[model samples]
Target: MTSTEPDARSSSTTSEGATSQPSGLPRVLSVTLTLAAVTITLLGLRQIGSFVGPVFLGLNLMLVAAPLFGWLVRIGMPRVVASISAVLAVYAFLVVFVLSLWWSISVLVNEIPAYASKFQELYLQLLDQLQAIGVSETMLTDQVASIDKQQIVGLATDLAKGIGDGVSIMAIVVTVLVFLSMDAIDIKRRIQLVRDAHPTVADALTRFGDGVRRYWVVTTVFGLIVAVIDVVALGIIGVPFALVWGVLSFVTNYVPNIGFVLGLVPPTLIALLDKGVASAIAVVVVYSVANFVVQAIIQPKYAGDAVGVTPTVSFLSLLLWAWVFGATGALLALPATLLLKAFLVDADPRGRWVNALIASRPGGGETPDPDVPEADEPDEDLVGVDGRADGENDSDDGSKPRG
Candidate 1:
């Protein structure tokens, strides 16, 4: 009887284990479905990129302008007036930005034609040098014969036309900005409603907004510093359109990792055509030293700290978003990534573990392991109105001091 009972118990245990563990087929199917869904969603976003890009840009602008809106209200301005003021401020910035770009492109279009003779001279000199280095003159000519003065001029003209074509996009952005600005007056109330229903989502969104603001603030400050240095360096180096290139640097600074390269190309090419190879080399060296120190080395550390994302993640985000949403996506990659993290990872308790892979700081965005007992530490990122960590205080009673 004992032998029979032991056999029956072993059989029961084995059966239970078999039922408890899920089959691999379901897991594989689930993963496949998820990947398909993500692909479809991304394709949809790309399809509507024209509309979505401007809307996202407007949202980002509103976030950037939120502090000014808040300050106006705090100073006793009526809500409508504050909203209008905030919208106008954003509009002014947009107008200035568009005008700067237009003026720069206009200057470039006019200047490009004058460089026709110089461009041809450089082309011949380059061909001669290549031939001297054992390159076949016939082969080089066949490969690059189409490159000429007209082509260069046409490229510049096309760039200007592209800028002109973006006016419709700007109009959409402006309209969206107006509505978003008005809606932002009750942002705190809306956040509270979200918090009541889904605290994790609310916290994620709050972090997203804070991260965007910090990222932009750091980038803008560093961009201005870099721009000023670049302008001075270019001017000393006799590079034409120093101010325009400076503005280009400032604008591209919003694109992480590779923006300096984009801002460097135009000035270097002009230096080559206008002055010579030596001037081009000087332009390259100046930009390499200045941009490398400021944008590549110093700025990333502060930006990473501000946005709570590692440099690797930032660069990958830039590539991914740029592919997904085009140029505007490139400009807003960091913010878009923040939004994705908020919804996909932070909003779901189970997915919070993913943060460990992407967060800039150690222990940032991590949840405690359930199996391990840890001290109940407050997150530094979460602060109260007085700028102290939530539930933290100097008073014995743990009560916040009255203002």
Candidate 2:
């Protein structure tokens, strides 16, 4: 009877502990400290961006290539051989791509003076029209005179040089990827270690990784589609450096909300210079239609399930991460946000209310992958990019929830 009484007391204690909430003072103190720590961390990240940027870029690339690496291993390839082959293939592709883009940009930079003359002409004409509307010509002339063409040209050249330097970091990034791929063979062991220690943390991390991969893969595919269409359209409209602009389109596509507008500026300005107002307007229209059809209309359909964040969350995240970690953080904003959500919101039983507050829908944010048979169930094997189950029993094999 005493043993049964003890069991009854234990059950009641467990029930009470589960339902209890933190006192108001403790909860408030916890929230304040969390915000303070996050702010400090962001400041530190921004300060060390030069060193950290390339590393994160490499990590993201590794994640993207993880599926191919897993597939190679599944085909009975040695881990070292498979890793080398996969890394080399990616390295070669990036080399060709960056070289082609640099060539296009160099050609465009040399021809900017010719375009500048036309832009000056247009600016003067616009000022004249404004003068006709009772605006003082001297006042406009003062404004125009303050706008130094040389300064503008210098700024553009500096921007191009900066981007070129950023691309050169691929050597370091690729090196890091090689090591990461090598370590990936023991990923299951590492995950198991974490699972043994903290099962809930392991579960959250697995979901986070899956979400990041799905979002990036879908976003990258759509970005390529947008780039191709933009390149073809710009070529047809006779925009200089069409290929460079297209590449820019591809990079900026990762950035949410305002990226399309940012990418539109360069080619449109070039069109205005080389062609005329009509051609520039035509360039704008083409970009608008293509961007709208692909990103606005189709991208969300695929990304909706992959990325559970709402449009508002995405845009705010972009701004917040940009401020926190500068440009690199901005590019990886969504994934970073997803990780934060996994830890701070999705991991806790109390997190449902927090998730609902941030979600686009009333039901809450996490969405089921239609491609996966039972996405709710934790997959114990590596899943392929095409959503097929692989014949490996491993965790951290960079598996997606699909297939």
Could you say which candidate leads in TM-score? 1
lDDT per residue, candidate 2, 280-394, as tens digits?
9999999899899998777765664575677667767778877766666777777778777767755554444565556545363463222222232233322223212355544
TM-score of each: 0.71, 0.71
lDDT of 1 by residue, 1-403 (tens): 9889988999999999998988656866866886798789878998998789889888888777777776675576766787789899989987777676567667777888999999889888987888898887788767687678798899999888756646767889989987887676555545545555576776677677778888888889998999899899889989898999899878767653556776788888888888899989998999899888987778777776677778888878778888888877887888888788778777776556666787777463433332333322222112111112233333422232334
Count clashing pairs, candidate 1.
0
Candidate 2 displacement at residue 92 in angstroms: 3.4
After superposition on all CA atoms, how large is the RMSD of candidate 2? 6.6
lDDT of each: 0.74, 0.70
